[model samples]
Target chain A: MSLTLVLVQTLNGLQLGVLLFLIAAGLTLVFGVMDFINLAHGVQYMVGAYFAAWFTAMTGSFFVGLALALPSALLLGLLLEILVFRHLYGRDHLAQVLATFGVILFLNEAVRILWGAAPLSVPVPEILSGSIVLMPGLLYPVYRIAIIVAGLLIAVLLYFLVSHTRAGMLVRAGATHPRMVSALGVDIRRLFTLVFGFGAMLAGFAGIMIAPILSVEPGMGDQILILAFVVIVIGGIGSIRGAFVAALLIGLVDTLGRSFSGDLLRLVMSPAEASQTGRAIAPMLIYVLMAAVLFFRPAGLFPAAR
Target chain B: MSDLVSSASTSDVPATPRLRGTVALLVPAAIFLAFALAPLLVHAGLDPFYLSIVVRIMIFAIAAVSLDLILGFGGLVSFGHAAFLGIGAYAVGILASHGAGDAFLQLPVALFASAVFAFLTGWISLRTKGVHFIMITLAFAQMAYFMMTSLSAYGGDDGMTLWTRSTVAGSKVLGDTTAFYYACLGALILSYAICRCLVVSRFGRVLRGAKENAVRMEAIGFDPFRFRLVAYVVSGMICGLAGFLLANHTEYVSPAYMAWQRSGELLIMVILGGLGTLHGAIIGATAFLFLEEWLAGFTEHWRIVFGPLLVLVAIFMERGILGAVTRRRR
Candidate 1:
């Protein structure tokens, strides 16, 4: 609607976009490098939030909680890879999907048992608790701004690491040709483990960052995981740049669609009908965008060379 | 037992003459026979509640068999199959709410809607192979789910209840629980036969050949995509039939009928029973639902036990329960 509302919603969209990027970056990489589908990847995000919540409560500092959660998340990822995912790499996609789905079930239920079904909330740190005025009348939460900034910084860091570094080159090589990379004497198994762990940590980091804003719940990651899948699919599987671009595109489209669809519909229809149709259409905008994208380019926006 | 062994091993080892005549007919006949006798057993002093459960199993078995057509035989791995189920149910619900409660009318509408959906989405989805196909199907299913949720005129997120069961040729025979059970059983039998015929026909062979090697199938003067698309549409129609039965069985329709989780469960059922075998899907539907029911009897947190068990099945029961049974016989 108005300029102020648009500005605030834009910020909200950016925040969601960054969170998606964090999760999708890891997802795309794992998918690209290993050709494995990890449905339980979302659980890592959930675990990260729970770890942040529990650790923050114990340590009495958000920063301390994050520091603890990151490594723990990484460890959990490694444990799962060693126990479950390692066997699935040699199997078919159906097997991988079913196995990981089992992991999701176990983890979601485990989280419920550990921390009852009630949603756990994390308080925003005192320093970033209040809203800061952007323009004359626009004010936004400082913590959200912090999340956006942090996400952007990580994206920049990821871009540099993926494009410039030696390990990054190996990753890129693995994505395009894993068998070739393995044949070249690189330890592809270890590389997969490393990538898988790092991706889990990144997803966990997203969870930890968003903990203060969103309710940390058992299945919270499931919905976001679907959104992240949409991001990767639209962006192109296995492309970080694609994930980043698509994540932002989806985030903005989804947020702005929800915010403005009613008003836009009212231009043609009665207010009541507009609101009802808008409510239905808003949640579907991203999927429509995804379908449209796939219809034109089945491989996605940035198909990683394979 | 001879018929069961013959049917179970017939398609699996078609290369050998000894196995060719057996035609895995026994298991399915046995399965249907057991289904037919289940209600009698309930009358003979078993829990009457179980008859309803078997009816539910048969309803899902139809959905699972439909999924197996594409997933196992066609190798399409459609992750949105539940959407067709929901479409079928919603068609029934919407029609009945508007005072049209005839099975003859609802069945055609459900099948037609599902076929249209499958054709359009399959046209797009079949373009991409592997994981892209899976994700796209899921996204489309989610779109359908959201669309259903947005239909505030028809209950929206909370779902809607059907006031009465659909009438068959203006007869309210389906109103009785036993009659409903028999109706569902008849529907499942019809669906199974349709799928069985399709999987064994020239069309089914093309689908199987394409699944094994699409390039080879293409080189042999067959268009794999067209075959796959047709198979996808047929599969959707059958799943929609299951949805129709489901609406009648529960007399309720909700957006939850097509959730991605339900789609996942359908995949599990197909895999659990053994993919590519129509009767295996029936066995899987029975096993999965029974397992859930048996586990739930212990505690509400049944998934905690069921989850790891699924992982074990994926790891150890690679061929599924039917495969396991057949292999042991060999």
Candidate 2:
């Protein structure tokens, strides 16, 4: 890759990483605090994209549509909490996994039923529709750049909240020592509900933000959900810092690997053979990285010192 | 649940004092005997379609039963068990593509590939516990899934059609549905018996011990990892053999065989049959496949009902199909 192409790919990777962070953050917090394995969390992201698509068209203004989506997504998250997820807290991992697997089947099908099985698109807002040139000839999409900025801002805000705020302390404390937190007269159940709801909102927020750039369709979340799980696992299940770092690393490796694997392979092999092998290996890049990391550090890089 | 675990061990023996003459032994024998006569039923004008369907179920039963050997008895919840199935199928597919169509060659390659895959992946996955174990297993399976989809030579995402089924000592026994059914059935029985014997052996005890309390097992001088790894390999090999049979039954192979959803279905079958019970896997696969077939006939959107049905079962039924039957008998 040329210097400009490399720079653009790095930015693209960052954009993807930021989206992953938004999804993984909520996932890690819930996992850390509640010890619940939610296979259906990806559906919440799907819901967000679908909700954003519908609301945007209904309202006919991108800002108004986004404004309406956040609250609706929050309410939907809460509704799922009350109806299904609340009862699952004390169950074993198998039970939790199977039940949530069922939820995935239901929700994916339900979305297809409600929205028809076609992909929906949200047009970029006029303000962010054009590309900005970074140098003499290098150009980047303004909306993608906005996503990176928004994601970074959220990361900073999340760091501040998790490190400084009272509620954040409770979440962190609960993650590391739930029994002690409860013994200290904290209403652990209430705190858990708040965390779960907030996590849902974050996943939803990720969905809405990416809706304009990607297809808003059923099963979109399943693949990303798996990626989020990989990030969470590599980052250490309950660690936010781990999630951020791992998410960025995975995003960069995946993007850069997909873009450059064939060229790298061509240095040693025939072009035909090189491109095929490269294409074959590109999708497996993150998983290979994960296996390597896990081999050296089985508990993950930031396992929250429990 | 604790009682179920202990009871599972007792039932492993041929004639336990407390479990002598229990229906568990009787019911399983009757079921197998019926399966042995399934071809006869086809001769009696039973739908040929039903024969193929049941063959598919039995193939999956082999997979699920092997999964139970580890997931239930060995206390290893591998979320990527389908990867073994894929590896096994690919071994056969790849070999056959290269002009090798003999079972002796294809099946063993399938077994070796699957065992190696399991050993390598299990070595890493077993290093972690709980949800990490689950996700790591899943990641490895996703890797297998992605790799298979990118194998452009073998038809890639579209998969490859087998020109011919594997032959047994120069005879095309696998091409005949009745013969193939018996072959799958016989393999299931053999694997089930092997797993049952393993469950009753000393090694099985260590594996089960690790499942119940790894620290306690460690304190008693058993690392539990070695035993779990063996169980994992054995399970993968058995599932691999199932994949071989599955490839023959369908006369095709696809990347879908290794999809994460397929792995989930294997786990579900093991649980639906009641975890840790050998016979439960067979019964669970039958129930699952039957429900899936019946539900799909009702509508294209059958998953809507099927999904909720699975949820209800997970919530309300603690013991699964066999668990309830055995419980009521007691």
Candidate 3:
């Protein structure tokens, strides 16, 4: 409503955007490279948060918890790839979807059994615990800002890793022309495992970073998984740049829409009807955005050259 | 042995044509026969609750059959199929709330609403291919889910309960447990017949051709998109009918009816029965619901077992229960 509130909401949206980017980055890359649709990707995010919550409580240090969670997440991803996902690479997308969905069900329930149904909380470390004044009468949580910064840093680092290095070259090549990459005698299998593991680690990192602020709970990833799917679809399945752009776009649009739709609708209709309609329309804004984008550009904004 | 397995598992081109033909016809007939006689079994003191479960199975089987029209035969993996189900359920709920509790009125409205929704979403969704299509459908379904949740006038997130079942021409036939069971069975039979006919017709051939090779189908002077859209609409209508039955059976309607997870379960049903087989969808719905019910009785956290079982099915049971049965017989 007010300028300060709008500013705070925008920052909140950015934080959400970065977190989405972290999750979508791994998802899109795995999708692009392996052409494997891992529905369990969201569960990996949930697992990361669970690991962080458990470790943070055990170690009594957030940093140490993060350090441990990252590898654990990576190892879990690799183990899945080796056990369940590897066999699925040759199967159709439907099989991949079904298999991963099973993984989601398993992991979600397993976490519930392990951690119980109640949501777990991670205390904000003392260094990043307080709110900072952004401007006059505008204060924001430092932890959220840190998430945004961390996400951006990862994005930059991912950019360098994907675009500048030899492995990045292979990944890019794999995305565009996988058979060609394989024909050139690259160990496509190893590359797939690495990409799958790395993507899991990135998603895990996102989970670990956001755990302090958000409730670490079972099935938390399901909703965000849908949001991240919207991100990758809007971004173009295999394009990291597309995922980044789309993630921020969705984040901003979703946050701003939820916050402003009622006020905006009030100008055109009665306050009561506007509020009701706005409430109905706000949660659907991102989906509408996605449908419109796909309708106009079926392959998305930046379709990877396949 | 590996070659034999591969040959048997090739669902599209069955290795034993005559055997498969007989099995396909017999499976549906046997399934329907069991359904038809299920009420008698309940009447004979086999637990009336079991009849309710079968009724639920028939309702979901209708949904699964409709989904197989697109997912199995047409190769359009619509992850939002549950939206139509919710639309149908909500139609009954909303109309019933306003005192329009006639079966004739509720059925048509539910069917029409689902048709319109399917047409619009499918038109956009079919523009993309493969994974994009899947995600787009999911997004649209989420939109539907959110819309339903926002309807505070209609119970919102908590959903609403129907006071009584819909009256058939002002008669309370549906209120009777046996009559309702027959009604659901009759609807499932009718839906199965319609979908089975569609899949075998020339129209179905075009749909299947598109799945095999869209470019080739296009080159052969058919517009795959138009056929797919029509199929999508028909499929939506049937699933809506299922939703109508689901509401009547459960005496409730909620936003949860259209959740993405429900859509996923629908997909699982289609896949679990055996893709591209109408009867398989029915078998799948039965198998899935029975498994869930059976597992739930053992412990509260049954998904721990069911989840891994699904993974094994995906990894091992490529052709589902139907395929497994046929393979074993061979």
List the global CA lDDT of all models.
0.89, 0.87, 0.91
Query: Which digits, one per residue and each the tens of the lDDT, describe model 1 over residues B55-166?
Result: 9999999999999888878888888889999999998999999999999999999999999999999998898888878988998999999999989999999899999989
B-chain TM-score for every candidate: 0.94, 0.93, 0.94
As for DockQ, the candidate ahead, 2 or 3, is 3
Give DockQ for candidates 1 onward, in order: 0.72, 0.65, 0.81
Candidate 2 stretches greater than 4 Å from native:
B1-6, B9-22, B43-45
Residue ranges of candidate 3 with Cα displaced over 4 Å = B1-10, B14-24
Q: What is the lDDT of candidate 3?
A: 0.91
Model 2, range B132-156, lDDT digits (tens) per residue?
Answer: 6787788899899999999899989
RMSD of each: 2.2, 2.7, 2.4
Q: Which candidate should be chosen as best, given DockQ against the real structure? A: 3
Counting only residues 3 or more apart in sequence or on different chains, how many pairs clash (N, Cα, C under 3 Å) in candidate 3? 0
lDDT of 1 by residue, A1-306 (tens): 899999999999999999999999999999888888888889899999999999999999999999999999999999998988888887778887788888999999999999999999999999999999999999999999999999999999999999999999999999998889999999999999999999999999999999999999999988898899999999998999999999999989999999999999999999999999999999999998998888789889999987
Question: What are the clashing pairs of model 2?
Answer: none
Candidate 1 chain B, poorest ten consecutive residues by summed lDDT: B13-22
TM-score of chain A of each: 0.99, 0.98, 0.99
C-alpha RMSD of candidate 2: 2.7
lDDT score at residue A115, model 2, on the 0-100 scale: 93
